[model samples]
Target: MGVLTGKTALVTGASRGIGRGVAERLGRDGPRIAVHYGSDKTAAKETVAAIEAAGGSAFAIGVRLGMPGDADRLWEEFDRHADGLDILVHNAGIGTSRPFAEIGEEEFDRLFAVNVKAPFFLTRLGAERLRDGGRVVNISSGLARAAAMPQLIAYAMTKAALDVFTRDLSKELGPRGITVNSVAPGIVDTDVNAAWLRASEEAWQEAAALAALGRVGTPADIADVVAFLVSEDGRWVTGHWLDATGGSLT
Candidate 1:
């Protein structure tokens, strides 16, 4: 049996990209994964199928975030499947590519609503159902600490807020032996960045050059980091922002 054979993990936005990677990785450890998707039911099912094909257990849960009662709605759906949670991976987030000056109020609010508020409230509610010694891993971005792209100012701000939440929540959940941390990645080659990143050879090369490793990061890279964090090996580590950035921040 794997290390997490009997555990239950909820990975938000598991339909695609980094979130899907995390879900699949954790599922491989034998946990019963709740594959959360915003609106893509088909993609969510595919994620579940992939996990099952790997000899893992998983089910899809769909709920649109950034709304008034998103967290509550999500938990309600989750309640139908499991009674408790052992791991909570808050990976669902939206990004804004608009420059600071061009971003409108609605756009900024929407970003915060989906990226920050959703996770904030979701964690608050999930904590009650989370077992002692459970894990809470928040997917953060390197932009939170560095001004990597001025155009993504609003997106960076949301991640910054998430990091703060990670730090503070760690203290709150420490007594229960629940570890909370933020894993910040840099320039990961996921579907989210595929459009601009794959536009030209020069574009891809420039992105790769930003990382000290001389190549762009992959979803698997981030997933491996998260797998370590949620495992028994990471029990003593908490309240930290892990840089899974391929040395980009260096």
Candidate 2:
């Protein structure tokens, strides 16, 4: 039996990219995964299928984030699938690279709504449903700690806010044995970054050079770190911003 054989997990934006990787990893650990998708039912189903194919249990839930009542809808759907949650992975987020000067109110609000507000409210609504010793991981970005990409300033801000939430919420939930943390990844090779990262060998190398490891990160790389954090091995680590950037910050 896996370490999480009888546990239940909810992964947001699990239809693709890093979210999918985390979901698959947790599912492999034996959790009944709730794969949450935002408008991509087919992709969500595929994620669920992949988990089940690996001899794990999973189900897909469709709920578009960034709108009013999103948290309510998400929890309502989750209630139909499982009795309680052992893990919560907030991986659903929207980002933009628009320069600071050009950022409009609508764009900024939308980013905050999806990236910061959603997870905050979702956790609040689901607190009672989360069991003791539960885990909460917020997928943050290295950009939140470094000004490497000025154009992505707004996006980075959202991540910084998430990290703060992780720290503060950890304390609030610590009494119940729940641990909260933020995992920051640098330049992961996801579909979202494929267009540019694969544009040329030079572009790829430049991105790789940012990390001391001299290689671009993959979804699985971040996934493994997340797997460790939500496992029994990570029981003592909480309320921290873990740099899963492959030494990029160094």
Off by over 4 Å in 2: none
How do the residues 1-250 of candidate 1 rate in per-residue lDDT, one tens digit apiece? Answer: 9899999999999999999999999999999999999999999999999999999999999999999999999999999999999999999999988998899999999999999999999999888999999999999999999866789999999999999999999999999999999999999998999998999999999999989999999989999999999999999999999999999999
lDDT of 2 by residue, 1-250 (tens): 9999999999999999999999999999999999999998999999999999999999999999999999999999999989999999999999997999999999999999999999999999999999999999999999898756779989999999999999999999999999999999999999999999999999999999989999999999999999999999999999999999998999
C-alpha RMSD for every candidate: 0.7, 0.7
Cα lDDT, model 1, residue 204: 99
Off by over 4 Å in 1: none
* C-alpha TM-scores of all predictions: 0.99, 0.99
* Model 1 per-residue lDDT at 142: 96
lDDT score for residue 168 of model 1 = 96
Worst 10 residues of 1 by lDDT: 145-154
